[model samples]
Target: MVIVDDHALLAESLELALNFEGYDARRVELPEEPPSETKLVSLITRSQPRIVLLDLDLGQHGSGVRLIAPLARAGVDVVVVTSSTDEPDWGHALHAGARTVLSKTMPLGEILGTVRRLNHGLSVLDVEDRERLIRAWMGQEQRIIEIRRRLDQLSPRESQVLEHLMGGLTVGEIAKLRVVSEATVRTQVKSVLAKLGVSSQIAAVSIAHQADWRAA
Candidate 1:
């Protein structure tokens, strides 16, 4: 097993406990000042641990949720051991392939027991936590459906304009890309904003992000 967390003291303690329990657990070291996602992923790949105990907030290194899917695909079961109380964080971690989400506040004995069970091919999640995750997923699904409906209301030209807007392009830049007059691009932008029920280009981009939408 491998532990990936920015809190050095907590990680070391967890490693010691795991080892005492007869598990071969180790902590990942980031020699670089601020670790990159690529470097962290490579370290896990080389270690090839059966289970990865991950923390979502890696200080300056950003969220560890990004690593969950890739680690799972690489045959490593990810157990998110995070202090984050945010529902979105929990939802994202589980959606990205984490087998279990354990709060850092959980008793050490319980944490170790959960890990042992996971290593033995058993999984566990509390009933309340499971319900929260289901609710979050349902809410996300509804948001996606609404965004798709709004997108479908757009005309072909309006859709093209919205895509460029979401790409961070200026009106002038979009006009240049499409070889259209700036006035024409502005007109299309207005139509897109109206159909999407947004007031500005930024709002349209926000909608795209919220729905995780990209141009088809």
Candidate 2:
């Protein structure tokens, strides 16, 4: 396993703990200006670890969040261990392919137990985090369903774009899926965000979890 965090002390401490658990761990202290995303992509392709313990806030890079989707796309499992409690981050991390989000403020034992469970193919999520995510998911679902119910308010193309958006596809990906230009998808995304009163994609997704909008 590998740990990516700007904090040296936290990295070292986690390394010690993992070593005690019979796991090999390494730390990568990314520089102020990280190498290209390509280089980080190369590292993951080369290392191919079992799991990545990622910190959401890594100074300016925030490579941790950026890498989640790519790593997951490459079949790598990620478990986020970060201080961010932003509802959108929770949904974004999961949408980006994280298996779980373990808060840093939790007890070390709980953290260790989560890691162990994740390693063993069993999920590790505290009840509170679990419930919170459930709510976020429900909220997102509700927003999507309501929007769809009022599809007449949207142009056919906008409705199509929104379908892809709700499926967690990035704007670029949605453009390709719809065989449209990137700019069009961006426009649709902006419109969707505005119509839903969401400032970001994360909030849009968090609104998807509402039971009223859970594909009923």
- Which stretch of 10 consecutive residues in model 2 shows the poorest summed lDDT? 207-216
Tell me the deviation in Å of residue 32 in model 1: 3.2
lDDT of 2 at 47: 69
Per-residue lDDT over 131-213 for candidate 1, one digit per residue giving the tens place of the 0 to 100 score = 68857966877887898899888887887788888878999999999999999999988888888888988999898778777
Highest-scoring model, lDDT: 1
Which pairs of residues collide in model 1?
none
Candidate 2 structure quality by residue, lDDT tens digits, 1-216 = 888777788778888898899987787657667777768766655667887888888777754778888878777778888888777667667766788887888877787788888888885666677667757866765666676554445566766666666677888898888788999888877886777667987765555433223332
- The per-residue C-alpha lDDT of model 2 at residue 185 equals 85
C-alpha RMSD (angstroms) for model 2: 11.5
Runs of candidate 2 with Cα error greater than 4 angstroms are 125-216
